[model samples]
Structure formats: structure tokens, C-alpha cells
Target: MRFAWKVFLSGILVTVIALSLTAYWLTQAAFGTALSQEKQKALDRMRMLSVVVESMAAEYSFSSEEAELAGVMRSAATGDFSSAALFSKDRRALYGRAGESAPMEELFEGAAAGLCHVILARDGGYDMHMLMPVQLGVATGYLYLAADVSAPFALSDEMTRTASLITCAAAVAAGAALVVVARLLTAPVRALSAVARAFSKGDYAGRAEVRCADEIGELTRDFNAMADSLEGHMRELAQQARRREDFVASFAHELKTPLTSIIGYADTLRSRALDEEERFRSANYIFTEGRRLERLSLKLLELMVLDRRDFPLRDILTGDVRERLTDALEAVLRGKYGVTLACALPEAAVRSEADLLQTMLVNLIDNAAKASKEGQTVTLTGRCCPAGYRMDVADEGAGIPEKELSRVREAFYMVDKSRSRARDGAGLGLALCDAIAGVIGTELHIESEQGRGTTVWFLLPYGEGEADAQ
Candidate 1:
């Protein structure tokens, strides 16, 4: 059964049982008291009748004939009495016919000694027989009186029936109230069940309404919280799936461009004899595309490693990081790219995985170098801030548009595709940097204008007790 019905039925059963027992007990007790009173009234009447017979026997002489004594007995047998009889000292019935087939000898003997009474069940009712000794002149007689005392028993039966009716009525009334109460109590549970069903059917927004400050309400709240968490995780999983799809498509496009160029150039060199200049040009094209392919493969490998592995952070001095970046960037940016590399860093210990941090910094500085023109400077600055050791890479190149800044970290997503391709950029540098920043428990914050410049910065927490490092 449903929970509400179970509760209702259980309550009804309890109410019926309790009311039944109470009514039964009350009816029995009242019946017993009334029956006792009826019995006492019957005995009293018997005694009064015996007194009247004794008075007559004393006033008149009844010892001469038995018919005279029987006449007195018949007169006394009036209102409640069913029958009356008289017995001599020898146990002879001298009055009305005896009603019950009892041992008269024993009754006469008991009467001679003292007044006695006995109640017997007869004809689905009760009868009380009283025996008393009456003195008649010089001799003594026994008066036997039988009275119908069945009215109390009849009343008791009627009371029992009435009690049963009351109990049933009470049970029905209580059952109705319990039905309402049970439904009210379980309403939240039903709502929660409905919400759960809807959620299972992919309606993540469904929620239970809490209507009371009970355990069921708390359960509803907890279920809503769990649903929220699950919905968030589902959305996150969907986004990850979309990202993987984009990454795959971008990866294929990057590979096709380089591989197609290399293959075409190689086929031309192999199929046809060309002049020295044309041959050199074809070979250089093949070599350049080959190099680009190699770079793309290395960046993809790094991204895969970052996704699959966990890196442990260690204490590294900011001065050492600055020196490494200068060595890695100064020669390439100045000689080849015609960009000056500038570093202004303090001596401080920051917690970071050394290789991942170096990779991130190199990518950022290289991107900055590529963005700048000859004599334009790419600045790498580090300082001790309240949050951590802060590092910024700023370039005064034609800055990224504000709209494009958000998507620049996506793999193979470049603001100027042709310009990026001319500089051998596969658009994976900022993507790799973003991944490295996540490994170091941080994120890149990039600020850019349409034409002014772009600044990319991130924070690394200070080493243990090394916040004051200088």
C-alpha cells in the first residue's frame, strides 16, 4: 500500500481497538452494578412478602388447615414474583405449584435455619428464589418466592449493542481524520517523488517544495542540493565533450595544413628537375612545414601529458625563474624576432612545479615576442604581492581585441590566422599556458585593449613561511 494509506489504516485499527476495549469495560461495569441493584431489589421484595405472611399467620390460626396458608401465599405472590410456594416442617408443598425442579427438602432445611436466596439462569434470563422461615401460631412454615430479575440482563444486552455501535462510529470518524492527517504528512514525500521522476527524465530544474520543519522537509532540501550538484556535473561533462570535439577538429586542421604542404613540396622535388633557386625554395618550404608539424606535435603531447598526469609543486626562487626566461627568450626574440626582452623580478620563493612553470612562462614570452615589432620590448616582471609572487608578461604589439581575448586560450583559435601562420604559430601557446596554470592551482588573467597592448598575468602562492622572501 501507499504510505498514506498505511498510516491511515494503522491509525484506524488502533482507534477501533482502543474504543472497543473501553466501551466493553464500561458496559460490563455498568451492567454489573445494575444487576446487583436488581438482585437486591428482588431479595428485598421477598423479605417483605415473608413479613406480610408471618403477620397474617400470627393474627389468624392457620395451623388447623393447609388451604388457609396456601391462600395467604397466593395473595403475597403479586408484582415481580413468577411463582410462590409454601412448605411445612416435613417438606410438603402446601401452596402454589413449584416453578423450578430444585431439592425442596434442602431449601426447607436452609429456610428453617435462616433466610437464603439463589439466582439461576432460566429461559435466557435470570430468576432469584428466596426461602425464609415463617412462624404460624405454634408451628413454623417455609415461604419460597421466585422473582424474575431479567430486566437488568436485558438492559445489559442493549447496552452492549449500543457500545458496539458507538465504537464503530468512533472508528469511522477517526479513520476520516487520519486520512487527512496522513495525506498532509506525506505530501512532501509525494512531491519529492514527482521531482525525482522528472529529474530522472532529464528535467534537472525540478525541485521539491518543503512545507514543514520535519525530517521529510530536510530530506527534500537534501535531495534538491544533490540534484543541483548532479546537474552541475552533467553540464560540466557536456562542456568537456564539446571541448574534446573542438580540439580534435582543430588538431586535424593543423596537421592537414602542414602535412599537405610538406607532401606537395616533396612530390615536386622528386618528380621534376628544377633550377637551383626553385629547388631551394621547395626544399625550404618542405623544411618549414616539417618544423611546424613537429612543433604542433610537441604542443599536443604536452597538452596530453597535462591532462593525464599530476604535477607536484616545489619551492623555486623568482630570481632563478627570471634568469631562465632571459636566457630562453633574449636570443630568439632579439636576433630572430627583433623584440627586446626585459625582466624586472625580485628574489622570492614561490611554490610551483618547475618544468610546468618554465613551459608556461616560455610560451607567454614567446607569444609576446611574436606580437611585438623590432625594437619593441616584451617585458616579464615579477614581484611579491599579498596573494603570492605575481608575474606579468606585457607586450606593446597590436593588442588583441577585447572580444577575442576570451577565446585566445582555446587551442588553434587565433585572432589573425594568416598573421599567426606566417610567424609559424599554430595557436597552441596560450592554450598550453592555461593548462600549466591549472596544474599550478591558478588561472591566467588577461587584460587587453583594441589597439593599446595586452597584459597576461598569474599568481603563484608563496612557499611555506617564505612570504617575506626578497
Candidate 2:
């Protein structure tokens, strides 16, 4: 059903079939070969006996050496045969030994005239014999020699059993090897299929493991490339949507502050009995909101411009880190929140951009100030790190939630919607901070918990300032 299943099954099926066919054919061939060799050897044994017996007959007829001939025949039997015989040209047994004596004519009875290896009885030994008539046309009695074939047959039987065992073992080993090859072949496919399923379920971060440099690896490379393209496109769309929403919210917040003050001023001026002090206060409120709106607009425009630029860092300088941090904090922390701002800056200079470093630190401190209670403390500390300088701004008020900390730095992203609007703030501080940090090559570090207050800071490469130069 699934692609991985198909791959696994296909591999296993091919291996099993191949092993089975090979074992069957090899076993058949081995059996045939062994049988042929055994049969040939049996025939050769019969032939060898023909030569031995013919010589014995010659000795008996030429030298009257019947005793020696019988002794030689008995020795050749190896105790596995009971009888061997030589008959004269008159169809009379010349030398007969079959456990007892018989008339020469009576014993020379059989009509077999060629070499033959015969299994004597159901429970006895085999006999390899050669019978040759001495004369051609008038063929009379011949020489007969016999030897047992039981040991050779037994040996052949043992070899056949051993061969069967070896074949079985080879088949088993082949099957195991096939299984291993099948699993190896199917592994990459299985990994890719799993990743594909994960991607289907909306996890674009899914990845497939590369197992080999074969076709499967090529396939995985293509699939991962496709996934990367899709993920980038999706992220682009999400970013565009968020930007649109942020623009609308920032505009509305900025407009509302000034419009509220303008409306108040208009109400006061319209009243017939308004005093001079009340008139001036109402007019001042209108101007104040307008100035706030102006500041919000300028900040937003600057952020937009910075966002389009590819700000790669160069022309770095070493400066007094403490002075830069204090200047930024003092400028930004002028609001009415009653919080102690603590700074622990090192009297050390490092390579960085001064203005960008100051801006980033100011924004982080400002964010912490907003999150702090009236009597809480916001502490700013600068320390030297392995790669660069570390700045920390920790607060003692309401902290951000564990999940929503990542989105807080987004333009117009307010964790507390109602409170943020009531404060007449445009929610651009963190966004501006993030942009400035990027321009100067630093990372914004934000940590938060529900009621434990929020901490936001930026670590920058420290650099030269006017104080350090002096």
C-alpha cells in the first residue's frame, strides 16, 4: 500500500526467489554429478578385476599353479567375497572356491560372459566381477573374479549426506544475506516516506536521513529541496500578512492619541465659561498628543527604511562600554515609572558601532521599564563574553508569557492589548530595537515569565566612544 512497504517487499521477494532457485538447481546438479562418478568408479572396478582374474587363469593353465592361483584370488577378495573361479576350455571348473568343493562342470554354470558389479543379496555385500571366455567362436568356461562393493557404496552414501547438508546450509546462509540486503535497500525509502508524511501534516521542518550515495540519496535531495522552497514561500506570506496588520494598528494608535486630545480641546473651547488656565491646559494637551503622533510616525518610517537595507558590518572601533550604556539608559528612562535602574558596566573597550549599540540598549531598557511596576527595579549589566559583549536588562514586574516572548518584538505586537493602548504607546520600541541590533550585528535576548517580569537585552560587540578617546 505504502511506498516503503512496496520497496521492502520487493527486495525480500527477489532475494527469496533467487536463493530458492539457486539451491534447487545446485542440489540437483550436485546429486547428478555424484551419482555419475560413483557409477563410473563401479564400472572401472569391474574392469580391473577382469585383468586380475585372466592372469590367474593363465598361470593355472601354463604352469599347473592352481594352489598359487587360488591363494592369489583369495587375497584379492579382501574377505568381502566367498567365491572366485577359473574354468577350463572343456567347460570344467579348474579352480573353484565357493566355501566347498563341487564337480567342475556343475559349478561352471552361469551364462554371464561380461563384466558386472552386482548386489548379491538384500542384506549382504555387493560383488564386482569380470567373466571372460578364453576362446572366441567356441566360447567355453572363463575366468571369474569377485570383490565386495559395500565399503565404496557406504562411502558414497556418506558423501551424499554431507553434500545435502552443505546445500541446506548454503541455502540458509543465502537467505539471511538476502534479508540483510533487503533491509539496507529499503531503509532510505522508509525514512523519506516518514518525512513526507510529516510534511503532509504541516510540519515543514521534517527531514529525511541520507543513507547512501545511490539513487535513493538523489531522490531525498530533490524532496528536501522542494520542502525548502515551500517553507520559504509560506514564511514570506506570513511575514507579509503580519506587516500589513502592524501598519494598520500603529496608524490607528498614533491617530487616536492626537484625536482624543483635539476632541478634548475642542470641547473646552466651545464652553462659554472656560477660564484662561483651563484653555491653555487643553491647548497644550492637543499639542502634546500631536507631538507624540509625530514621533511615532518618524520612528515607523525610519524602521521601514532600515528593514530594506542589507546592513553588513565594517569599520568597527573600540570604545568605553560603560559610558555608551549609561547615556542610552538615561535618555530613555525619563518617564514616571518609579523603578530603580541598575547598571553594571565594565570599564573595558571592544570593537563595535557606538550609535547602534546605544540605541539597542536604550530600547531594551525602555521595554523593561514598561513591564516594571511603579516601585520595581530594572537592572542593566554589561559583561565580556567569549565572542563579544553581553548586555542584560532584567525587570522586577510583570514578565512575558513563556510562549508569547518570541512575538513580542514584532511591530505592534502587544502582549497586553488593552493596557498597551491605554498607555498611548505605538508598540514600536522593541521592533526598533530589533532593527538597530540587526544593523549593528547583535542578537536580542528576551526572557519572560507570567508574573516574574520581563527582561530584554541586546549583546553587541563593544566599541570606542568619545569618553574612551579622551
Candidate 3:
């Protein structure tokens, strides 16, 4: 059954049993005690009457004189005794309430039971009964007496009624008390059960409201903690899913760009109409595009491996930050754009992941070089932070807008989509840098004010103890 109903029924059943036993015991006890008191009173009266009769017999018997026996009967009529009678030893009634016969027949049939009480009548209605036998000796006549048992009978009946009333009231009180106790005890458990159901249905935010310092409250606290952990895990899973989708889409596009160029030039070379010069030009185009395709594939593979855990860290190398910055800037500035590469960096060797570090620098510097006016400096700055190191690649020309800075590192999130396409980017460059920075426990920060300039940089934590906030 439901919990509340079970508690209520149990309370009721217990109360009923308790009251029933109490009523039965009290009823029996009151009746028994009343009967005993009455019987004792009757016996006392019989004893007194017997004493008077014996004394009279001793003084007047066999003297040829008639004795007044009425005084003896009258003398036995005290408040404690009812009808007192004189009986011969042979079971003859001498006197009593005018034809009151004592049941000496019972004494002959069984033991006297020693002044026992029976149900009897004062005036023939059988209100209650008590009788006692008295004998001067084994040969003398006996005196018989019964108490006026009406009062005890009435009182016993009243006591039975009172006990019954009390039992009923007690039953009702016990039932109410038990019900209240059960509800108070089980409230926290019920609330916890409800919250468990809610949590089973996937509401990780569900909580039991049990607040006391007991088992139920401890269970509630544990449930809330589990939910908090589950929610955090779910959020992490969602974020990973988004990152995966972005990675796949961007990687596919990057691969397709070089593939399309290589295939187009190769097909041109295959056409039979092309002469030596034309074929040479086509083959050169194919060759260049093939190299670009090779680079794109290698970069994609490196990034994919880095994204997964269990990829071994390639050794930590100590290197001068300034030297690395110079090499990366020189490599990007080789184009006829005449973009000047400027480096401002610390001379000291810093711990770095060489391949990842070089690539990160190349991508930022290349992008800066692409956006710069010829003869303008694409300034590269390397500095040390409390955490390991920092590098900035900033360009003055055609600066990225402030609003798009945050999303710039996002895969394929080009602010100038058409211009980015002409620059022959696989669009995975910044995304690669961002991922590498994350793998090495660093952050890539970007800042731009519209029409001013854009600066892309990385912050490398100094040690494992360095604080990182995402």
C-alpha cells in the first residue's frame, strides 16, 4: 500500500488490540474484586450471628424455656450483612428474611468453598448474592448470612461501563498519535523518494528537501552532489560535440582546396592538345599545387593527432623565443608583398614544444603578413609572463574588426571570407594554433580595435602549478 495508508492502518490495528486487552482485563478484575469483597462481608455477618446463637444456646438450651431468637436475627442486620439465618446442622433453616433458605445443599454436593458469593436477590430480583455458613462445632447448628450485594453489582456494572469508555477513548487517542508519529518520521523519506524519481527521469537538478542531520538528510546531500557532477559532465560532452563538428567541417574544406587545384592542373596537362611549353607550365602548376596538398595533409594529420589524448608529447626543448620568432617571420615575409618582419623578443631560452610552437608562430605571422601593406612592418613581439612566455604577431594594415576577435580562432570563421579565399588558406591555420595552445596548457588571446590593428598571441604557463582559467 501507499506509505501513509500503511502507517495509518498499523496505528489503528495496534490501538484496537491494546484497548481490547485493557477492557477485557479491567472488566474481569473489577467484577472479581467486587465479588470477593461481598463474599467476605457475608462471612463476617455469618460469624457474628453464629456467635450470638451459640451463646444463647449455652445459656438457655434444654432448660425447658423458649428463647427469643428474633433478637439474634435483628442483631445480625448490620450495614455489612443482608439476610442472616440460623440453620440446624441437618440443613434446617431456623430463621432469616422470612423464608430465606440457605443453600446447604451446595455444601453437601461439594466443598463449602468457604463463604463464597453467588448471584442472588434482595427481594427476588437476583441483584447479587453472597452466603456464609457458621457452625459452633461439628455437632452444633449453623448460622447463615448473605451480604446485600446490590451496591457492588451496580458498582461493577458502572466500572465495566467506565472501562469500556476509557478503552474506546484510548483506542482513538492511540490511533491519532501513531498516525502523527508515522507521518513525522517518514516525511523526509517520502521527499527523498520523490526526488529520486525525478532524478531517474534525467532531471539532474532534482533535490530532496530533507534538511535534518539524519540518514535521510545525508542521502539528500549525496543525491545533490551526484547531480552536480552529472550536470558538469554533460556540459563538457556537449562542448566536445560542438568542437568535433567544427573540426570535421573545417578539415574537409582545407583538404578539398588543395585537392581541387592539383586535380585541375593535372587534367589540363592530360589534354592531348597541349604542346611542350604548355605541358611544362601545366606540370609546374600541378607540381606546386601537389606540394601545397602535401603540406595541407601533413598539417591536418598533426592537428588530428594532437586533438586526441594518448598522443605522446614530442620532447620539451629549451629554445630562445627571439630566434624562433625571427625564423617564422622571415619564412612568411619572403613574398613580393615586401611585408617587413620585425622581432622584439627575450634572449633567454624558454621551455617550448618546438614543432607546435613553430607552427603557431608561422600561422599568426603569415596571416599578419597577408593583411599588411608592402613596406609596412609586421611586428613580432616575444615577452615573458609569470606563466612561461608570450608572443604577439601584430599587423597595422586592414586590421580585423574588434567584434570578430573572439571568433577569429574558430575554424573557418573568416571575417573577410572572399579575401581569405584569395590568400589560399586551408582555413585550419588559426584553429590548429588554438588546439596546440590548449594541448600544451596555454591560451591563445586575440585583440583588435576596428581600423586600428589586430594582435594574436599565446600565453604559456610557467609550470604545472601555474593557474589557468578557462
Candidate 4:
């Protein structure tokens, strides 16, 4: 059954039962009081009739014969009594007729002792019979009186009918009220259920309104909280999916360019007889494209490894980190790129995964070198700050445009695509640095002005072993 119906029926059932019992008890009590009063009235009238009969019998000098006593009773009997009878002291009927079903022997025995009355039920009504022994001019006689006392019983029946009608009316009214109450009480639950259904159909914005400060309202709040969390997680997952899609597309395009060049140059060298200069040019092109492809594959592999693994950090002197980064990049930057390398180191220790930190620093400095002119300097600097040890790679290269800075960390995103391709840059350097920074529990911050230069920096929190570091 629906909850509303269950509530309504239960309320009605309780109302009917309670009201019925109360009505029955009240009617029965009233009927009992009325019947008692009626019985008393009947007995009082019977006593008065007995006294009148005694007075008449004495005044008329009545005999023990049935006809004489019957006349006396007929004259004396006036109110309430339907019939009167005279019985001899020996228990024989002497005057009026008595009921054959009446307890005559018992009535006679009671009268011989004292005045007595009994109410008897007969034919859907009641009769009160009274008997008493009287002295009739030295002759003992018994007077029997019967009064119809069914009025009180009829009144009781009427009261019962009225009570039943009242009980039924109360039940109906209560049922109507209960239905409204049930619906009001369950309104929040119904709203919550509707919201849940909508949410199941992918409507994450749906939420149940809290109507009151009750348990049901608390339930609605909890459900809304859960929905909010689910929606946020779903949005994050979708963003991750989009990033993956973009990464795959970019990766494929990068591979295609390098592989196409390598294949074209190799096919040219293989398929035709060429001059030494042309042959050397094709071979060199092939080798450069092959090297670019190799670098792209290695960077992709490193990115994947970073995603799949967790790196543990340990204390390393900031000076040592600077030396390692400078050593790793100085030869390539100064010799190959003709870029001057400079380092400004501080005496401090930072928490970092050594290999990952070095990899990230190398990428930053290499990018700095690539962006700089032959005589320009790429400077690596370290400073101890309250928050952490800050490291920066500042380059006097052509700075990135403000519009392209936001996307520079995306894989294969290059500010100057032609310039980058000419320098064999696959545009994965900053992307790889960003990933490494994340693994080290930090993030890369880049600052650049269009014509000035670019500065890439990160911070590593001070480590516990700072005092012992060189």
C-alpha cells in the first residue's frame, strides 16, 4: 500500500477503536444510572401501593378470599404497575393473575421474609416485579406488583445508536485529516525520490529542497552533498579524459612529422644515385629526424612513467642540486648552443627526489638555452625563503607571448612553431618539467614579458636534515 493510505488506515483504525470503546463505556454507564433510578422508582411505587392496599383492606374489612382482595388491589393500584396480584401466605395465588414464567415460589419466600423486588427481561423489554407480605386484619397476605421498566432500556438503545453514529463520523473526519498529515510529512521524501530519479538519468544539477529541520531534511541534505561530490568527480574525470585525448592527438602529430621526414630522406638516399653533397644532406636530414623521433619517444615514456609511479623525496643540499644542474647543462648550452651558463647558489637543503628534480631543472635550463642567443646568458639561481628553497632559471631568450604562456606547458604546444621545428624542438620540454615538478610535490611558475625574457621557477620545502647538508 502507499504510505499515505497506510497512515490513513492506521489512524482511522485507531480512532474507531478508541472512540467506539469510549462511547460504549459512556452509554453503558448512563444506561446503568438510568436503570438504577428506574428500578428505585418502581420499588418506591410498589411500596406506596402496598401501604394503600393495607389501608384499604383494613377499612373494607377484606377476607382471605381471592375476589375480595382483588377488588381492594384494583382500587389501590394506580401508577406504574401494569398488574397487581394477591397471594395467600401459603404461596397460592389469591387475587390477580401472575406470569406463569415468573419465579413465584422465590417471590413468595422473599415476601414472607420482607419486601423484595426483581427486574426480569421479557420480549425485548424489562419488568420490575415486587412482592411484600402484609397484615390484613389478623390474616397475613402477599401483594405482588409488576411495572414495565423498558423505557430506560429503550433510551439506552437509542444512546448506543447515537454513539455509533458519532464514532463513525469521527473516524471519517480523522481519516481525512490523517491523509493530509501523511502527505505533508512525506513531502520531503517524495521530493528526494524525484531528485534521485533525475540524478540517475544524468541530471547532476538536480537537488532536493530541504523543507524542515527534521530527519527527512537531514536526509535530503546528505543526498544533495553526495550528488555534489559525484558531480565534481564526474567533471574532473571528463577533464582528464579530454586532456588524454589532446595528449594522444598531439603525440601522434609529433610522431608523424619526424617519421615522415626520416622516411622521405632515407627513401631519397636509398632510391637514387646522388652527388656526394646531396647524399650527405639526405643522410644528415635522416639522422636529425631520427634523433628527434628518439627524443620524442623518450619524453613520452618519461611522462607515462611519471603518471604511473610515486617518487620518494629526501634531503639534498641546494648547492649540490645547482652544481648537478649546471654540470649537466653547461657543456651542451655553452658548446652546442653557444649560450653562457651562470649559477647563483645558496647554502640550504630542500626535500626533493634527486633524479626527478635534476630532470626538471635540466629541462628548464635547456629551454632557456634554446631560447637565448649565442652570447646571451642562461642563469640558474637558488635562494632560501621562509616557505621553501626557491630555484629559478632565467633566460635572455625571446620571451613567450602573453597569450601563449598559458598553453606553453601543454605537450607539443610551441610559441613559435616554425622556430621550434627549425631547432628540432618537439615542444615537450616544459611539459616534462611540469610533470616532474608535480612528482616533487610542487608546481612550475613561469613569468615572461614579450620582449624581455622568460623565468621558470619552483620551490621545495626545507628538509629536516638541513643543518647537516653541505
TM-score, per-candidate, Cα-based: 0.57, 0.38, 0.58, 0.57
lDDT of 3: 0.63
Model 3 spans > 4 angstroms off: 2-35, 57-107, 111-116, 119-144, 150-184, 205-210, 221-250, 269-404, 407-433, 440-445, 449-470
Cα lDDT tens digits for candidate 3, 83-105:
55555546565566322443446
Clash numbers, per candidate: 0, 9, 4, 0
**Compared to the true structure, candidate 1 yields what TM-score?**
0.57
Q: Roughly what TM-score does model 4 have, to 2 decimal places? A: 0.57
Candidate 2 displacement at residue 360 in angstroms: 22
The CA lDDT at 344 in model 4 is: 92
Error of 1 at 148 (Å): 2.7
TM-score of 2: 0.38
lDDT of 4: 0.78
lDDT per residue for candidate 2 within 1-470, as digits (tens), equals: 85545655665566556655665665566656754565566556545654665554543443365565556556654432335565555655556643222223332444343443333422544444434454212233455545444655565456656666765676567556766766778789878989999999989998887778899999999999999999899888777766556555545533542364466567768865678897786677667546645765655444453244443344343234454444334433543456667778765665454444544555566667777777777887766776566677898877777788778777868887776665556677687677667766677878777788776665556454523442
lDDT of 2 at 200: 92
Number of the candidate with higher lDDT, 1 or 3: 1
Clashing pairs in 3: 120-128, 120-129, 388-461, 388-462
lDDT of 1 by residue, 1-470 (tens): 89999999899989988888888888889888988998788788878887888877775565686777777777777766547777787667777755665556566667767987776788888877778887865688787887777888888889889988998889889988998999899989999999999999999988889898889989988999999999999988876775565456545544543454466668889999999999998788677556645665555454452243455688998888887566445655776678898999888889997766876787788788778778999998988888888899999989998788789998878888887787778788788678768878888999987666789999999987796643
By TM-score, the best candidate is 3
Looking at model 3, report the run of 10 residues with the lowest lDDT sum: 461-470
Q: Rate the local accuracy (lDDT) of all candidates.
A: 0.78, 0.60, 0.63, 0.78
- Please list the residue runs of candidate 4 whose C-alpha ends up more than 4 Å from where it truly belongs after superposition: 51-67, 99-125, 132-142, 236-247, 265-470
